[model samples]
Target: MFDIKKITVLGAGAMGNGIAQVSAQAGYQVIMQDITEEALQRGMATIRKSLDKMASKGKIAPEKVEETLSRINTAVDLEEAAKDADLVIEAVPEILDLKIEIYKRLDVVCKPEAIFGSNTSTLPITVLGAATKRPQQVCGIHFMNPVPVMPGVELIKGRLTSDEVMEVAVNYVKSIGREACLAVDYAGFIVSRLLDVVQNEACKLVMEGNAPEEIDKAMKLCANWPIGPCALMDLVGLDIVEHGLGTLENDLGPEYKAAPLLRQMVRAGELGRKTGRGFYEYNK
Candidate 1:
C-alpha cells in the first residue's frame, strides 16, 4: 500500500482551501500553494472560519481545529510546496490550459511516488494526465463544492491511470470521510453532467420569462430539492456554469448549449455568492 502523509494543494481558491482543510483534518501535513499572498491569506481565513464554525457546532473540538490548522502551511512557490508531497491535488480555475500548465510544473517537482489529482468538473482526466510524463499516476479526484459539507467525491481514472493509483485515491477520499464513487473519464463525469442539464434548463426558464424566485420556490416545494436551481447555479458561479455547459455542448450536443441568460450573466460578472449577485442577491 502506498502511504500518503503529506498533501500539496494548488490554488488557494474555495475548492483549494476546502481540500487543504479536509486533508489536514485527516492528519496529513498540507502545503496550500497559490501564486499570490492575498489569495493565500484569503484561503487561510476561509479555513479558519470553517474550523471555527465546526468547533462552535461541537462537530470538532476547538483543540482539533488548532491541530488541523497547524498541519497546513501556505506557500507562494509551487516547486517548493510540491517538493515533498505524497499527493498533489490541483484545484485551480476550471480552465483546461491552466490546469495542464500546473500539472506540467508539478510533474517536474513532485516526488516520484506522488499521485496527481485534478478537481475538474468537466475536463477529461486523460487529457489532463497527458500533460505530464507520469500519466499512470494521474487521476481525477473531483470533490463537490463546499467540500467539507459534501459527503461524496467522484474518483475518475484516466486512460493510463494505474489500479494502484485508483486505490490510493479511494483511500485518500475515505481518509477524509468522503464516499468515493468511481466514474469513467468523460466530459462531465456523472453528477455535473446530470446536474448541469437541470441548471441549464433553469436558466432557459429565466430566459423564457419565468421568474427566478418562482422557479426556485417551485423546485424547492415540488421537487424537494434542498436548494433551487437558480440559487445552486449562483453558488457554483455563473462563469463556471457557462464553461461547463460549453464543454458539454461541444462533447455531448447542442441540447447542452448554455442558455443565453447564463452567458450574459457571466459576461456581466454577476457570479452569484462570490459577487453578491446572480440569479438572486446575497448579503455579502
Candidate 2:
C-alpha cells in the first residue's frame, strides 16, 4: 500500500480549497497551490472561514480549526508543491488541455510512487491518465461541490489505473469521512450526468416561460428535493453547469445539450452566487 501522508492540491479554487481542508483535517500535510499568490491567499482565507464556521457551530473544536489550518500550506509554485507529494489531486478548471499540462508537469516533479488524481466531474479519467508517465497511478477522486459537507465522493478508475491506486483513493476518501462510490471511466461518470440532465431540463423550463422561482419552489415542495434545479444551477455557477452540459452533449449525445437560457446566462456573466446572479440574484 502506498502511504499517502502528504497531498498537493493544484488549483486553489472552491474545490481545491475544500479538498485541502478535508485532507488536513484528516491529518495529512497539505499544500494548496494556484498560479498566483493572490489566489492562494484567497483560497486560504476561504478555508479559514469555513473552519471557523464549523467551530462556531460546534461541529469541530475551536482548537482543531487552527490545528487543521496549520497542516495546510499555500504555494504558487507548482514544482515546489509537487516535489514531495505522496498524492496530487488536480481541481483546476474543466479544461482538458490545461489539466494535461498540469499532469505532464506533475509527472516530472512528483515522486515516481506518487498517485495523480483529477477531480473532474465529466472528463474521461483515461484521457487524463494518458497524459502522465504513471498512468497506472492516475485515477479520479471526484468530490461533490461543497466537499466538506458532501458525504459521498466518486472514485473513478482510468483505463490503466491499478487496483492498488484505486484502493488507496478509497482509503483516503474514507479517512476524510466520505463514502467512496467507485465509477467507471466515462463522461460525467454517474452523479454529474444525472444531475446535469435534470439541471438542463430545468433551464428549458425557464426558456418555455415558466418562472424560475415557481419552478424551484415546486420541485422543493412537491418533489421533496433539497434544492430546486434552477437554484442548484445557480449555486453551481451557470458557467460550470453550462460547461458540464456541453461536455456531456459532446461525449454522450445531443440530449445533453445545454439549454439556450443557460448559455445566455453564462455569456451574460451571471454566474450564480459567486457573481451575484444566475437563476436568481444574490447579495454580493
Candidate 3:
C-alpha cells in the first residue's frame, strides 16, 4: 500500500463531514471541502460536536478532540482542497451527474497518483471510475452513516481499479479503526442494498395500516435488531432511502423500487431527522 498522509473529502453534509472526522481522527491531514463557506463551517461544527460528544462519553480522551480538529482544514475550492492530497473521498449526494462532474474536476486538479474514492452506497463504482482519466485509481469507500461511531466500511473495487489502490484503501480503513468488507461494484453495495430493502418494506407495512411504533417495537423485541427498520429509516432520511431504492430498482429490478408510501413521504418533504419528520417526528 502506498503511504497516504493527506485525504480530501468533497461535500460538507452528513456523510462528508463524518468521513472527514474519522480520517482526521486517524491522524490524516484532511481537507473538508464544499461549495459554500456556510456548508464548510456547518460541517466543521458537526465534527466538533461529534468529537466532543465522544470525549464526554469516555470513548476518547478529551485532548483527542482538539488534536483531531487541528488536522482538518476547510476549503470551498475543489482545486484547492484536492490539489495536494494523496486520497480524495467524494461524499456528495447520490446524484450521478454531480459526482461525475466532481471526478472530472478532480482529474484535472489532483495528482496522478491520488486515489479517488466515492462514499456513494447506491451508485456503481465502475461508472464513477470511468468518468475520469485515471480509472485505475478510482474505487468506492462507502462509509456508513454516523461515521465516527460506525466500525465497518464497505470497500469496492471498480472494474479498472488497481490492486495497489485496493491495498491502500484497506490500509486506510484500518488506520481509521474500521474493518473493510470488499464488495463488487454494484448499485446499493452491501449495507444499503439490504437495509434499504427492509426500510422499503417497512413503508409498505405502514401503508397497510401498521403503526410505525409497533413495527419498530416488534423488530427490536423479537428480531434481535439494535434498531428497528422504521426508526432506522427516520435516522437515514426518508428521501435518501427513496433515492437509494430507485437506484436499486434501476439496476436490479422492479421489485427493488421504493414503496408508494415512501415516495409520498419524500414528496411531502418529511425527510426524517434532517427535516424533522418521517415515520416519526424529531425536534429540529
Candidate 4:
C-alpha cells in the first residue's frame, strides 16, 4: 500500500473543496488548487465553514478543527500543488476532454509513482486511464456529495488498473473514515444507475403535466424516500442528472433519454442550488 502523506486535489469547487476537507480531517496534508485565485479563496472559505460546522456538531474538537483547517494549503499552480503529492485526486469538471487534458498535464508534472485518481461519477475509468502515462496506477475514487456526511465511497477499477493501485485506493478511503465498495468500471455504476432512472422519470412525469411538488410528494410517500425525486435532482444539480442520463444512453440503451424539461432547465442555466434555481430556489 502506498503511504499517503500529502494529497493534492486539482480543483476547488464544491466536490474538490469537500475532498480536501476530508483529506485534511484524515490528517493528510492537503493542497487544494484552482485555476483562479478568486476560486481558491472561495474554496478556502467553504472549508472554514465546513470545519466550523463539524466543531459545532461535536464531530471534531475545536482544536482539531483549527488544526485540520491549517493542514490545507490553497494553491493556484497545479504543478506546485502536485509536485510531491503521494496521491493526486482530480476533482475537475466532468467534461471528457477537459479531464483528459488535466490528466495529461498531471502525468507530466507529478511523480510517476504517485497514484492518480478521478472523482468522476459517470465517465469510464479506463477512458481516464488512457490519458495518463501510468495507466496501471489510475483508478476511480468516486465520493458522494457532502463528503463529510457520506460514509461510503465507490472504488472503481479501470480495465488497466492494477491490484496494487486498487489496494492503495482502498486503504486511502479507509484512512479517511469512509467505507469503500468495489465496482467494475461501468456507466452509472451502482447508485447512479438507480438514481439516474428515478430522477429522469421524475422529470418525465413533470413534463407530462404533474407539478414538481406533487411528483416529489408521490415518490416520497410511495417509495419512502426522504426527499422527492425532483427535490433530490435539484439538490444534486440538473447538469449531473443530465450527464448521468447521457452516460446511461451511451452505455445501456437509448431508452434512457434525458427528460425534455431537464434539458430545457439546464439550457436556461437553472442548475440547482448553486445557481439559486432548479426545482427549488436555494437562498445563500
lDDT of each: 0.93, 0.93, 0.92, 0.90
Clashes of 4: 0
Query: After superposing candidate 4, which stretches have Cα over 4 Å from the reference?
Result: 268-270, 274-277, 280-284
What are the models' TM-scores?
0.94, 0.94, 0.94, 0.93
Ranking by lDDT: 1, 2, 3, 4
**Cα lDDT of model 2 overall?**
0.93
Give the C-alpha miss distance for residue 179 in model 2, angstroms: 0.7
Candidate 1, position 10, lDDT: 95
TM-score for candidate 2, residues paired by index = 0.94
- Candidate 4 global Cα RMSD: 1.9
Candidate 1 lDDT over residue span 1-284, tens digit each: 99999999999898999999999999999999999999999999999999999999999998998999999999999999999999999999888889989999999988988999999999999999999999999999999889989999999999999999999999999999999999998889998998899999998999999999999999999999999999999988888888898998887789899988888899899999999999999999
lDDT of 4 by residue, 1-284 (tens): 56889999988998899999999999999999999999999999988998898899987899987899889998998889999998999999888899999889889998879999899988888988999889999999999888878999999999999999999999999999999999888887777888999899888888899998998888789878888988888888899899889988998799889989999999999888879999887895
Clashing pairs in 1: none
Ten contiguous residues minimizing lDDT sum, candidate 1: 246-255
**Residue 281: error of model 2 in Å?**
3.2
How well does candidate 3 match the true structure, expressed as C-alpha RMSD? 1.6
What tens-digit string does per-residue lDDT give for candidate 3 at 19-79? 9999998899999999999999999999999999999999999999999999999999899
lDDT of 4: 0.90
C-alpha RMSD values across all candidates: 1.7, 1.6, 1.6, 1.9
